[model samples]
Target: MDCETGFCKNDVQCGGAGGRPPASLAEFTLGGYGDQDYYDVSLVDGYNRQVTIEPIEGTFRSTGGKYDCKKAGECHSNLLLSCPEPLRHLNSQGHTVGCNSACTKFNTDQYCCRGDYKTPETCKSSTWPVNYPKYFKDNCPTSYSYAYDDEKSTFFCRGSNGRISPDYRVTFC
Candidate 1:
C-alpha cells in the first residue's frame, strides 16, 4: 500500500475471494485545516516519516505607538497585552518590567492612591506584582527616582544626589 497527499493505492485480488483493504490505507485521508500554513497534527501510525514546512510571513499594517524598549526600557500603550507567565518572570526579574506609568493616572480616587505624588514609584510599589523587583527596591534603592533620558536613550534610576547610580546603570530592557 502507498499513500500520497490526496490518494492511496492498495493491491487486492479481484476474483476467487475478495481481499481485504490494506490496513495501512484504511484510515488515511486529507484531514487538516485547508487554509492554515501549518497543520496541528498527530500520527497514530507506526511509520516515522519527517516533514518540514517553510514559514509564511504576513504583512498586516498596525497603527499605534511603537514599543521601543531599546530606548525607553518600557513603553506605555494600550496595544500591549499581558506577557505569558514564563516570559513575565524573565522580563520582570531584574526590575519592574512592562511598567507603564504614563497611562495610569494616579489620583486621590484611584485604588493605588497613597499620597499626592503620582509617580511610578508609588504605582510600582503598590500595584505592580510582588514576584518581581520594584523600581526603587531593586534598581534605585538609595535614589528612589527614575527618568527616561532621551539623550542617553535609557531609563536611569537616579540617586538622592541627582546622579545616576552605578547600580542603576544596568539595562532593564
Candidate 2:
C-alpha cells in the first residue's frame, strides 16, 4: 500500500517506501500520535494453510517477522504434531493434519470464552483441554492461539502519513 502524507517505520528494519516503515499496505512516520498503527494475526479459529508476514521497512519498533499456519519461517507451528489429540483434524488420506480450537473442536463454553468464562482470567490458555493453546502459541508467538491472548499477539507500527485507523492482511502461503 502507498501513503501519500506519512511514513510507516517497520520496527524490524525491513525496507520501507522512501526509507519509511509500513504495514501490509501503508507507510508512516513516528513523531505524531495520529500516525500510529496497530495490528494482529489470529488463529483463534484454526489452521488450514500457510501464511507469512514480514515487515518491509520503517523507523518504528514493529520489526516485522514471518509466520505461517504451519510454521514461523522454517520453525514448525507444530499444530499437527503437538495439537491435542481430541482437537486434531485429518485429511481424506486419514493422516493427522490441521488442528481446531477447543471451542470449535468441542464447542464448550469454557474453552470458547463464553458463559462463565467470559473474562480473560476465566478463559485462560491453561484451563482448556491440555496445552492446546500453547500448542499454537509456542508455534506462532505473533498470532493468537486462544481466547485470552493479549499483548504478545499484538503488533504496532509507526504511521506518518497523517492517517488513522488500521489495516489487516491474511495471506495463504
Candidate 3:
C-alpha cells in the first residue's frame, strides 16, 4: 500500500510514529474508559483518502439512542475531487493529493478551535466565516470533520460480558 500520506520512507510500517497531516485517520482506543472500544475515522488533520472502520462482533448499544457501534467513515466519496481550492493540497505534479482542513490551511483560531474557541460550546463549526467542516460532514457523514464532532463522530462498542472487545476492520482507499 503506497499511501500518499503516512508513507514510511521505504518502510512498510510506521513503527509507532504517526502519519503526517492531510491524511484520513482511523483512530482507536482499545479497552478505553468503561471497558469499551472507542473508534472513529478522523479527517480533522485533513483528508488524503477515504477510510472506514467496521466492528466485527460485540455487544453494541446506543446508550441514550444517540450513538451506534456501526461502520464509520467514507467507503465511496472521494474528497479530493471536491476539495475547496483554498484547502486543496497539491503534489509536485500539480495534482490534488488531499483536502486540507480549514484549520490546517488557514491556521486561524476560529477554524482550529483554539484560543477563545477552545470549548465545545464556543467551537461550533457552523459559526465559522466559512464552514469547511460541513463539506467533509456532508460528504462523509460518519467521519470526524473537525475537533468537536464527538456527538456524531465518536463510536464505541463493549464486550458481551466485559470479557471480549470487538475486532475492527479498517479499510482505506
Candidate 4:
C-alpha cells in the first residue's frame, strides 16, 4: 500500500502481500523568473524509466503584452497578444486547421479576438471552431485574459470587460 511521490501502488499478486518495490517517486525543483517560476522534475518508474520535466512555467515579458490581461475581454485592445502558438489554426474545440497568416498578430476585431470570439459565427468560420471549445466563444467573446491559480496548477482566462471565462488548460506536455 506504499507509494512514491508521483506514483501509486499496484498489487498484481494475491492478497497484496509481496509485490514490487514501491514505484519510483518524482520530485521537482523550481527556478524563479521575474515574477514567474520554472520547474525541473525528476521522474522514476519501476521499469527503470527516468524522465526530467523542465521549462514548466511561462509568462509575458513584453511591456505591451496583451495576453497578460487579468480578464478575457480586457485583452482585446492590445495588439501584443495573439493566438497561442499551438492554438492558431485550431478552433475553440482544439481541432487543427490552417489559420490566416495575418492572424499571427493580435486583432481584437478578428474571429479569434482576445480571449474567444463572440458568436460561433466568429469561431466556426475561423480556426477557433476546429480547435477550441464553445465555452471559449461564450466566455471570452471579445478579449483574452490570464490568471494563475497555484493551488490548482491552472491558468484561467477572462473577457475584455473583465469577465472570467474558461479558455485553455495547461498540463505537463
Candidate 5:
C-alpha cells in the first residue's frame, strides 16, 4: 500500500530506520515508572493519520482525579481536512495528506522546544507567534500535540507481579 509517511521504502517493516515524519505514533514504555506501562499517541512529530492506543485488561489508577489508564488518540478526527495552510503536508496529487506540527514545519527553537526554549517553562506555546500547538490539541484532544503535552496525553496502566500484561490495540484510521 502507498503511504505518505511511514512508507518504509516498500518494506513491511522499517528495519532499523525510523518512519518518515508527519506520521502518527503510538509510543509505549512497557513496565516502566512504578511498574506501569506508559503509552501515548503522539502528534509531536506531526500527524499523518488518526491513531488510538487502547489498553486491554489492566488495573488502572487515578491520580488527582485523572485516570492513569485509558484510551489515547484522535480516532474520529481527520486532521488533514482541518490542517492549517502553513502546516499542511500535500501528496503528489496536491491533496492534503498530513498535518505537520509547528516544530516540524518551522524548525525554530520556539516551535521545537529547543535552544533557549529547551525547557518547558520557556517553551510555552502561548508565547509563540501563532499558537499552533493549540490547533493540534483542539483537534486531537487525547494526543500529544507538542513537546510537553504529558499532563493531558500520557497514560499508564499497572501490569506487574505476575499480573496479565495489558495488550495494546493501536488503531490507525
Candidate 6:
C-alpha cells in the first residue's frame, strides 16, 4: 500500500472499482496527487454503481459542508435508478456496469469539453444532455458529472502525520 507517485497509469485497482462489493469498499493508494492526497467521488465518466466517500477526519467532516454532493429528494433523481434508455450499459448478465458520459456515449466535442470547448464557459453544463448529468449530479453531488467540475470535485485528505495518506476508504451503497 505504498505508492510514492501519483496514481500509476496502469493501476486499474486504484479507485476500488472493477471488483465486487465489500472488498472494494476501501480504495487507497500510497502514492497521491501532487503533495496532498486528493480523492473524489468521481462520476464524470458515468456510473451505475452508487458509491460515497464519507470522510472520517477531513474537511468534509470538519466543515459539515455538503458542497456539490448534496442529498437529493427522489429515489430516481437521487439514486441514479432506471438509467435513460439510450445510456444504459449492461454486462453479459444484464446488470448495469456503469453510466457513460456524454463524451463517451456520443463522442461530441461539446459534450466532451474538448476541442474549442475545453473551458468551463465554452462547455457549459446547461448546454449538455439534461437528465444524464442530472442523474449523476443528484446521485453524487460531490463528484464531477462533467469536465469542468475539478475545483469542487476533489477532496484533500491527510493522516495525523500530516503528509497526505497511506490509507483511504471509498464506500459503496
Model 6 C-alpha lDDT versus the unseen true structure? 0.52
The digit string of per-residue lDDT tens for model 3 on 54-163 reads 87665544454344578889634688898989998888789999888998889999999999999999999999999999999999999999999998899887756445
Worst 10 residues of 2 by lDDT: 19-28
Ranking by TM-score: 5, 3, 6, 2, 4, 1
Candidate 4: stretches off by over 4 Å: 1-7, 10-24, 28-34, 43-47, 56-173
**Could you give candidate 2's per-residue lDDT for residues 16-109 as a string of tens digits?**
3332211112212223354455445556666544444333333233334422112122225555676567766765777665567666677788
Worst ten-residue run, lDDT, model 3? 58-67
Q: In model 1, where do residues sit more than 4 Å from their true spots?
A: 1-79, 83-103, 109-173
Clash numbers, per candidate: 0, 28, 0, 28, 0, 6
> On residues 1-173, what C-alpha lDDT tens digit does candidate 1 reach at each position?
53321112254333533222111111111212421111111111111121111111121111222311111222232111332232221122353132222112121322233454345445443443432223212332221111211122212121223322212112211
Residue 171 error, candidate 4, Å: 12
TM-scores for all predictions: 0.15, 0.61, 0.86, 0.17, 0.89, 0.62
Top-TM-score candidate index: 5
TM-score preference between candidates 3 and 4, better one: 3
> Each model's RMSD to truth, in Å?
25.5, 12.5, 2.6, 19.1, 2.4, 7.7
lDDT, each prediction: 0.22, 0.52, 0.84, 0.26, 0.82, 0.52
lDDT of 6 by residue, 1-173 (tens): 42221223467464733432111122233336544455565555566455665445443222234432232211234233466656665567775555566665787888888898989888887877554676666655666677787665655544445434434445555
Cα displacement (Å) at residue 127, model 6: 1.7
Off by over 4 Å in 6: 1-35, 55-80, 92-95, 129-131, 161-163
lDDT (10s digit) by residue, model 5, range 19-103: 7778888899987867778889999989988999876644444353344667888545678898999999998999998888899
Candidate 5 backbone overlaps, count: 0
Candidate 3 lDDT score at position 166: 67
Q: Is candidate 1 or candidate 2 better by TM-score?
A: 2
Candidate 5 wrong stretches, greater than 4 Å: 58-65
